[model samples]
Target: MSTTYKVPIGPVHVGLKEPVTAWLELDGERIVGARVRPGAIHRGIEFMARERNPIQVIYLSERICGICSFSHVLCFIRAIEDLAGMTVPVRGQYIRTLVLELERVHSHLLWAGVACYTIGFDSAFHLGMQLRERVMDILELLTGNRVNYGVATFGGVRWDVTPELAKAMREMIRYYRREFTPFRDIVMDDPIAHARMRGVGVLTGEEAVRYSATGPTARASGLRIDLRKSSPYEAYGDIPVEPIVPQDHFGAARGDVLDRFAVRVMEVYQSLDVLEKVLDGLPEGPYAAEANLNKVLASLKKAEGTGWGIIEAPRGDDTHVVHLKGGDENVYWWKVRAPTYANAVSWPLMFRGNELADAPLIINSIDPCISCMERMMVTDGRGDPRVVTRAELLERCRRKTFDMMGRRA
Candidate 1:
């Protein structure tokens, strides 16, 4: 018998691009053990509240991640609204939900593209990206920007939807469904696809619960939990969120790559269902509250207050924690959290015993978006540095003199 050798996966390399580092103790082809460390993209945004006002905070908060920015701003505003006792108009709620769903569609589509690319399926990846362009167009038309949709305000939305605009959105979505149909088949119904994914990374329900996994990772393990249903935010509470138990769609996956693929395809349909409901229920009124930017800023002169908000980000349940203490000083403590926190914790469980080559596929299952919000280590990794991973990003990063660049090849 040959002696088992260890392998180093990251801390800087590309192809499987990510800032996350993993040390795999391998006995030949089998993983004897694995060590994970994340946190390469820490921005120290947590303490910026002491220097920024509530309005200015929105801009800073949007810096979290392009994909999760809207959710980040929405959750933060919700928390501040909770403290200020601000109630958005009925119209605002509907618009907020619409914008979020659009964001949801955008995020899922982007991931679908990335997921397809992860497995070397470029055709599916291009289709996903092509379809995502329509979603971005819708966002740009409605919110004036795509990715970081700054459409959310503390008490309401920054934009409004008209009948013509709504009709335009409907038309665009219908057209994209045509593209989604063929690609969905190519990814989901392909036998080879299942062979690669179906039972590859099997994290059972019990293990998922023990690890406190949330979002798709937990869903793949057969857990039926969605913050939209339990917490009831925006229009999701009013919209139908049927869990695709034996099927896939933001619900459960078989804890494998294919299961992850299936979840995204189904979510596309569910998101459309939500958009229809929002359009039907949207009430006519002011899109945002009349809070003066300057006055609101002045009122926020209070030295300190603590607030927190949670939203279902594209990757999973994104959460934010805020703390402030009244003082004359220019620095106040503010903390931000992302869904990557929960998903990152679940990595070790998924990686253990998995084959060496399967590491990227397994990590992609969480659709981990390590760059969202801020990266933090709940607890320190044994002796090495922390490397963040989320949303199927597996490119090993290489640090250069001027910058850390991901080498995908």
Candidate 2:
């Protein structure tokens, strides 16, 4: 008879990048069952939006995720524009698309490097990180900041693609095309990488659908679903994007860690193509419909309706909904549904029947941003609701850390 033991992978673990707890039921080294508990950090960003006007929320949304900050900002801005009935100029649309693809490249590179690091492939990891700087440099040249780029605005982008910026972007695209393949081949062609990743952390196509997995997670499982292709928005309408699936390229979609890795690697190439198209067909017009902030706010003040903005973010479909009250200058209520929230649902399924050592790789396979997905509401033992203040939360964090270190705070 076999006796099962319970093991916890995280809340704070060396293997994880972010704080998330996974309780695993193990029989020896093999995982029997798993339960994932997120919400280690609750930012309360959506709740904070209620106090600020539409214009102020743009910056707030950008802080949602460092890698995909612009995705959140664009999504939030689009939601507000939807309610306000504002139109983005043609040039603005193309510029928005350009930034979106650039962000995708940046995000994929970071994730790939992190994935390599998770598996102890340090050389590939370093190469990926080095390759990522090129895109970041172009992003900084265009928006003046690499992360949390304050580029997207209410009606359109705050910045325009000048001739110098365009030349830099083209150069960056060519650099990636020439340099990225060697790094990708380093891992993908390695027998040791195949031994570790192939057939590990499997989530079948049926499982992906049942769990409502989106983005590359779903695509890795052989689902040909891409929001850019299905519901074309922004520049995706102009530039055609076909979803990259494992079966299409590798002859079969095993829906394992390897497939997920392949999907993301291929996407880097796809983004390069999209960036080229965006630059070649770049339009000439006002980048922002109305650059005057006061007028944009004044127009939004009178608009009273709920609007949604959904886009194919780097991870997956990012959705934002905003409601504006007629007389109120501040946003009435706001909600965000990030891609990690959807992709995380399939984690337990992937964890089943895998080794305990594979836990970290499986969790990191989704490229999850725990901060983007966490939303917490505190309550007492009797189910009585209570608000946990910022200072209280900080104290709790300190106490937890001290306790873990076998000390009293």
Measured against the true structure, the TM-scores of the candidates, in listed sequence, are: 0.86, 0.93
Residue 346 Cα positional deviation in candidate 1, in Å, after optimal superposition: 1.8
Backbone clashes, each candidate = 35, 0
Tens-place lDDT per residue, model 1, 30-111, is 7777776556666667656657767778878888777868888888787777655677888898898888788888888888
State model 2's lDDT.
Answer: 0.91
The local distance difference test score of each candidate is: 0.72, 0.91
Candidate 2 clash pair list: none
lDDT of 2 at 372: 88
Candidate 1 Cα errors over 4 Å, as ranges: 246-253, 302-304, 325-331, 377-409
Candidate 2, residue 302: the lDDT equals 91
lDDT of 1 at 237: 66
User: Candidate 2 at 351: error in angstroms?
Assistant: 0.6
